[model samples]
Target chain A: MGIGSDMYRQQILDHYKNPRNYGELEDADIEHVGENPMCGDTIKMFVRLDDDEETIEYVSFVGDGCAISQASASMLSNELQGRSLEAVRGMDRDDIIDMLGVELSPMRIKCAVLAEKVAQDGIKIHDGELDVEETTTE
Target chain B: MSQQAETLDVERIREEFPILEREFDGTQLVYLDNAATTQTPEPVVETITDYYRNYNANVHRGIHQLSQEASIAYEEAHDRVAEFIGADGREEVIFTKNTTESMNLVAYAWGLNELGPGDEVVLTEMEHHASLVTWQQIAKRTGAECKYIPITDEGRLDMEAAKELVTDDTEMVSVVHVSNTLGTINPVSELADIAHDHDAYITVDAAQSVPNRPVDVTEIDADFLAFSGHKMAGPTGIGVLYGKQHILEEMEPYLYGGDMILKVTFEDSKWNELPWKYEAGTPIICQGIALAAACDYLDDIGMERIERHEAELAAYAYERLTEEDDVEVYGPPADDRGGLVAFNLEGVHAHDLSSILNDSAVAIRAGDHCTQPLHDVLGTAASARASFYIYNTKDEIDRLVEAVHDARQLFA
Candidate 1:
């Protein structure tokens, strides 16, 4: 990799190339789709809750987007396993940026955090706090 | 190289734009985003500074010396744009915020009133959202049906489809003169003939065409034309809309306020004359003046020379990019395109490509380029665009190619 191009570190490229948990959960109790209208990066997140209905049993996503966005989804999916819905909902922009380990511009921040948004919105939709046709990370 | 390209002194032209000398670290800035906006030259910047320093007054407002100077220069800017586009002086030119507003001015003032339930508005699949959305909303409001002219496999406007679509029911035919995403130089003049044959008025979105080449509204028989100033080396927040005098006079004003009013009562008002009637409140006086300087700068170099320079650069970039492995360049063959090239690198997203290229100080645009439907047609979510201008060189494109090569390897 070229110097000064740390944004595409090997870790990010690895996750982007072989995304972990990169598929849909057919039995997902909570599913939501989000899109970054700026770059047309879309992520549809699927989360299945355990019998307690609080802990995430499994999480996966399927969509087309840039490396930052898709890798973000992959990394976030791995992190979301066994986490409670409350924990996923509590996740914010800083957590995603911290996980990426890169200084993201405001535009890239939207791409980096799109998966988190979809997961949170899916929880919100399940709880009946928000109503919308589709969630978007504007 | 073509004769016109040979006549252009690119080195001398590069001197006018000090921004070209900018460096990211030790690497010199290779600006390939001219399709988004061009770098402002010293002349246009000086004009803007001079207006603010010496004649910072509202035009057509005060009788003072500064106001008079501002008014005259601002009015002359309209005439300059008129001459630039081969239109009649001042009478047909109206300054709006940008090309989007200029298009809305037409869609609202003409389309809203002229179009009805059965009327059709024929646009192309390659239209920028500025034209497509404005007309789409207008069609929704007016109950007019919007039809699209499809594109050919070569990424050019299907003239046959356009001819078939623009029937007697078509009231307005608006298309971009150059596809900003594909760099396809559409056959607008022929499309104008078709629109006219069916008694439909045609509008040309010259946002891409006006900056890169010699575009004559008269030669194309365009009833209306729109272009932004910033895309041509002027300041932002200023754009030009040129319409036929008769049509402009017959239509009601799109906006209404102080400057656009000749007389106003509590319940009634008489709108101002042709151009002023459309310019509502206090206008972009300084920007309008500076845009004239941009026109002057382009004229001094001769637009034909600039066009040839960009054409050659685009063709070269296309050739070089196609030489790269798994690089899919969009648009027609280089001979039939404008100054831009949009492409995709296999297994690399456009945004990722843009970021990687940025590390090498090679700037390019990455996104849908405001042509989402067009991207759908291209079957890609987004593409990277490298656009050229008068100051860009083959050497810069070489740097871009080398950077892309590095990016591909890095991704691999």
Candidate 2:
């Protein structure tokens, strides 16, 4: 009556349980914190970029959140580690959603993608390139 | 206890709520989110419909027959609500948008005047954001200190901590009668006594308690009590703030507008009497009438019986859910608790669990439940909550158990 056992694949649990690269990066050039007050999920993304902002020197995350959010942060931190700041900032919602390796409902999508969005926002804010107005959820 | 429980016809009472008749997917609509808001009954809906169709008019100002009828109906609803909570008089019941607004009214009007630099407003760590944030803003405005009575790991409020925090300098003690997240009902009557002894006022956020249990403002000895109509099977956008008459007379009007003014002068306007002074502009007439109908519905069912029924249901839910190998339930597993269970599955995140449950057409709240501080204390960012009301039944609980087992299998 439900999805197959592959839905709870061991790899997913492993990533969720012992999330990779889950901590703050010291001497980071950019930092952003996003919070879901509805679920009390807090994610902090730290990015340390090299001079000229062409390469990502380091990236790490520290957050108190659900397993999906933590795992998403872990995956995001790993994916952005060697990528350029421009590449990281250019990542869209679908790129991060696909990285999660599981389907997310509309409501849970925000929780899964919050870390990636925060990273992009942090980079934009730090690079003095933030031009868009903040979006308010009803 | 068994004989007393037998007096209430559970099945008959469940028939009153129309939502119980509907089916969700293949299963019956097992609404366990009553603490969030109860399902409105036919009578309450009819009351609103009747008002809008027949006698919908601006209240307190009209001399026409329909307008007078509407005005009377609105005031009568106030009287009904006032009596339901054992308030001193209908004049003490001020209508606001919801419990949040009611709390803000007290915070802005009363607390702003009484609370100042070096003064303290004591609150519990278990309060919802509505109660906690209002006082926090008040503290920020007055340079007053906001102290908290911490809860133990078991979700019980520490009286020793409360005693230490509530002192001569404490001007107000605002606490939730029942925690919406944990479902732990506090001993507010005793707390009110303690607050009064210290010459401090007590305000209770009865948003969770009023619907499930019988609340008497006089018995609790509360200076002010606030609850939302939506939570009690009434329409939304309407709430009641029950203040002691003398205390209400002392506070300034919350908003300046028509119906709240007694004598209008450009320089200064005198405010109207007790409840009307606080109710600025046009009231939620239909919502208030619906709220009165809701009050009548609950009263007819008897609150004590409803409380016992929910306690039994909660106990059943706790025992059944905890029987699973990997589930962790929050709050005390006692008859004293309200009919709410906040829990987590070992391998599944709460949002995932809720989504799966939604797929099965089961409606349960999956989030912080609006008590972030309490969630922090529980050591979880989110939890799946199943809260019960009059419409819920043991069969629904059984279905929930089956669905939960099925949900875990998805994670497995």
Candidate 3:
């Protein structure tokens, strides 16, 4: 289990075992759901904005998926607090991978990035740049 | 040891597959992902290389010597596959790209013309995306209704529900011979009888069955049967669709241009013979010949013995995997299923389990196995599948169980 241990780091497992900010937020200012169609991993992100509306006051997520996906969502939710909506949207694949603290393969990369995509797509929908439909990370 | 294992020279059979001898890091490869595709043995591989080396030419066209040899070998491949599947003659066998193409061929050429708004097409809940999606799109185009035979709690098709579903309005009944995810061996012959009683055409998607067991199209009295070579120790890009001669004669061509024509004028064109009429353009020449070699190889080992070997493996896998707590194995009892096991460990997603198993050099499938609807019915996002073939062994299954235990530990 040498290589497998490396892929599922202690930090990632902690996040997966005890996910932070995990659940639906009541009357969220922003809400979006996305799914990895290939593996059926889903993440629905919810955000409550600050008075400025550009800043994220609270964020939560609810879904079922592999360890990488669930852990990434938990880590991403922890990172969301006190961050600007723009900053959250600016969060890229590298930021999520850095948060997870593990190297992912091509297929695992999708699981790692699903949370980031859900957050970004939610912001886009809130801004009316994209329609409010269920997004998919095919 | 299982009685089937005693009859089969598994040690000798394993030697034919060099890939099985491969080592990942310090661990050996324990490949159990046979449902997706089987690894080709040396003989089939040699057949492929031999074709290109000696007589690599376009089939059924040129007057040259190379074309004659290539054409004869290609036609013989058809005869071999027809005999393997118990088709009447080579005329009943038509080679296409793969099983999906075969399903599309029947859907477009038969369903589109025969179905109308009131017409119904019956299928099972356990169909792979190949047949399910193909028929769904066809139903949309033809304004026909699509009905699915519900599965019982044990993951077998609900035959009681089926009799209620297939009425006079039903025009077609397409079903998978084996469930790719559940590993349930559907009673397609019984389904065929029901379809026939209702005067509906039945097509069997034998992609999972033909590679692992003896499938007789004549005994089933099927209108059409589809299977892929890649899943049967043959090369990719080749598949067979066996249709009764009279039915194939009545249907229009699915593809056009090139060799599938009698003659063509500026105004119109007449079609070619039975199988050729459906396969337009240049067919998979070497792949077809290599597929025949695969059939010959399976025959030499005996398909009944192969079927028995897989069933024994599946039962063993089911029992071993079930011994672990929170490990839910899907499908029927060991004796009732095909050569695979679909399962999940609690709190450990299939991808994670698959990745952990890879650390031990164990390869298994982790996804919906192309049966999204079936997964939905099972109330799972996805599942992990360990499929067996002729070459797999009980020792490899033990390795899989050990890796799964390792995955459970890591997740826990």
Q: Write the per-residue lDDT of candidate 2 for residues B108-147, one digit (tens) a residue.
A: 9998888899899999988899989889988999999998
Of the candidates numbered 2 and 3, which has the greater TM-score value? 3
Q: Estimate each model's TM-score.
A: 0.97, 0.89, 0.97
Provide the overall lDDT of each model, using Cα atoms, as 2-decimal numbers: 0.91, 0.83, 0.92
In model 1, the Cα lDDT at residue B237 comes to 93
**How close to the true structure is residue A75 of candidate 1, measured as C-alpha lDDT?**
94
Worst 10 residues of 3 chain A by lDDT: A1-10
Candidate 1 lDDT score at position A1: 32
Instruction: Give per-residue CA lDDT, model 1, range B144-220, as digits (tens).
Output: 99999999989998888888899999999999999999999988899999999999999999999999899999999
Flag regions of model 2 displaced more than 4 Å: A1-37, A40-64, A70-87, A94-103, A125-138, B1-7
**C-alpha RMSD (angstroms) for model 2:** 3.8
Candidate 3 residues A1-138, lDDT tens each?
Answer: 445667888898888999999889888999989998778889999999989999999999998889889999999998989899778777788898788778787778999999999899889888999988658473
- Candidate 2: lDDT of B259? 92
What is the Cα-based lDDT of residue B71 in candidate 3? 97
| Interface RMSD of each candidate, angstroms, one decimal | 3.1, 4.4, 1.8
Q: Compared with the real two-chain complex, what DockQ does model 1 have? A: 0.56
Is candidate 1 or 2 superior in DockQ?
A: 1
